[model samples]
Target: MTTSKTEGKQCNLVNHDEIWKVHINMELESAKSWPQKWGFLTESYNQAMQESSKVTDRILKLELPEHLRTRPPTPPEEYLETTQAFIGWRSAVPGLQLERYGRVQCGKKSFLKELGWALDGCS
Candidate 1:
């Protein structure tokens, strides 16, 4: 459980910590298959963004260096334009595509790693 902060007052989840640690999972929804929505996750992510001004501000246009990008760009391939081609896809990549561009991610980094550097003061 989690609580929203309003008017600088500390709030608590009915029986749980205000700050939570949980896994929000997504499947590998390929282009060929139908899609599904994770509404609870969407709401949770939105709430997280709303709670942190710093996250909301930079979340839209995160410009991580190549090494920091969750997935490196697909490698160039030589194709005869005959068969379907996908190169450099290493593993399952889960994220939400934004309206115009960019993404909001559920990542592979450990919680402690994220706690130390994912949000503020990344180095």
Candidate 2:
């Protein structure tokens, strides 16, 4: 009958609309993860660059007088232990660790004050 055929077409149209909405939602969710994924990738790239710079620094340091070099070349036997220690010793804030290692005591810890100073680093 004509009424039955019309009803079937309307049901198909409704299903297609639902399918479109689901597809859109999936795409939107995937888009949401993109920024977080890029952030992780950026952090990874920064760490890699830092490691490369450390190697470059060591190479440049080879040109300096041997006594002035801060890092001594690693001996083979302790390599794994040293690497593990170095890898585990780091936190999100590396500058703080370096400051502590140098015994440079920051008198008072104020997050806002330090953030201001960090922002002013270009100047």
Candidate 3:
């Protein structure tokens, strides 16, 4: 009985050691394959970077002729104030659609009347 117990313990130890060796081998294989995986990831990242650079270049080239790109000098404070007031008044009027009517018969007469009164304090 004692000899058999000793043999059983040795068998268990050998099985455990085999399991540990297999795990270590798998880990080493994964480590060895890392460079290929890293290369694939790096290639994908470089392609994305190139595409983003192309999009940025296209946007900059297309937007170069707009008024925003010219950086004109600032308008006077009085002009800015007047423009803001006109914009505010136009925005306050509800559902003011001007595209549906002729210029002579449209809401422009009413709008101009109110705007003139607001500007010159005369109705």
Best by TM-score: 3
Per-residue C-alpha lDDT of model 2 across residues 1-123, encoded as one tens digit per residue: 224657644356677689999999999999899987776888889999999999998897667653333455578786644655654554324543545566667678766576776645564
Q: List per-candidate RMSD values in Å.
A: 27.9, 18.9, 17.5
Q: Compared with the true structure, what per-residue lDDT tens digits does model 3 show for residues 41-83? A: 8888999999999999888777453322433545777355566
Higher-lDDT candidate among 2 and 3?
2
Q: What TM-score do all the candidates reach, one by one?
A: 0.16, 0.25, 0.30
Better of 1 and 2 by TM-score: 2
Highest lDDT among the candidates is held by which one? 2
Candidate 3 regions exceeding 4 Å error are: 1-38, 64-83, 86-123
Residue 54 miss distance in model 2 (angstroms): 19
Q: Which prediction has more favorable lDDT, 1 or 2?
A: 2
Better candidate number, 1 or 3, judged by lDDT: 3
Q: Deviation in angstroms for 55 in model 1?
A: 9.0
| lDDT for position 31 in model 3 | 89
lDDT of 1 by residue, 21-102 (tens): 2211122333223324444677778778778977667787878765336533444493333222322232222332123354
Model 2 spans with C-alpha error above 4 angstroms: 1-11, 42-123
User: Between the candidate structures 1 and 3, which one is better when assessed by TM-score?
Assistant: 3
